[model samples]
Target: MFTKKILIDLDGVLNEYGKDKFNENYIPEIKIGAYEFIEKLSKQAELYLFTSRNLMLATKWLINNNLDKFFKDVTNTKLSSYLYIDDRCICFKGDYCNLFDEIEEFKPWYRK
Candidate 1:
């Protein structure tokens, strides 16, 4: 089975965007179960971080949250990656509700 490369967004997905941006110099607490969900995905596929957040902020967040090790690479606006995971994303498939279902059943998981 082939595993798809995953590109995850940091803000608004992994971490909440509720707090003041300036106050969030730190990792800003993660969303519920975000870390667990990513960790699960990381085991089966090549994980990459693709975010518009500043390098310093993004790096600090990853380090503090213990997520840096899960990612193969971290990319900002200057880079490109396949299969972006973001809060503000449009589904390629007509049925948006099945997005997670699709990802969960992607390869090895589906074969199982």
Candidate 2:
């Protein structure tokens, strides 16, 4: 079996960005169940975290939450990756007409 490489985003996917009003702290507010979900996925395939945030900030957030171990690498805007996971993306498996169906069936945290 060929395991696919997955790249995940930080600001919205794993961490909630701008959650607190006008708060400029470097700290990241982690999404619910994000750490465990990433850890499980890491065991199945290659995992990469791609974020536009400052490297030091992103690194510190991951390290503080103990989620750093799950990622094979952490990238800022300077890197390239495959199969990016970001909230801003509209992803689907097949034809456009089937997009809604695919999304309805898609569950990143669980597989059958």
Task: Indicate which candidate wins on lDDT.
Answer: 2
C-alpha TM-score for every candidate: 0.67, 0.68
lDDT of 2 by residue, 1-112 (tens): 8877888888767875556553445655788899889989899878877877677777888888899898877886534445778765566556699777767776443122
Q: Candidate 1 regions off by >4 Å?
A: 1-3, 19-27, 77-82, 92-112
Best by TM-score: 2
TM-score computed on alpha carbons, candidate 1: 0.67
CA error at residue 102 for candidate 2, angstroms: 16
**lDDT score for candidate 1 against the true structure:** 0.72
TM-score of 2: 0.68
Model 1 agreement with the true structure over 2-111: per-residue lDDT tens digits: 76787887767787654545454555677779889989999988888877767778887888888888888778753444577776555576667888877765542112
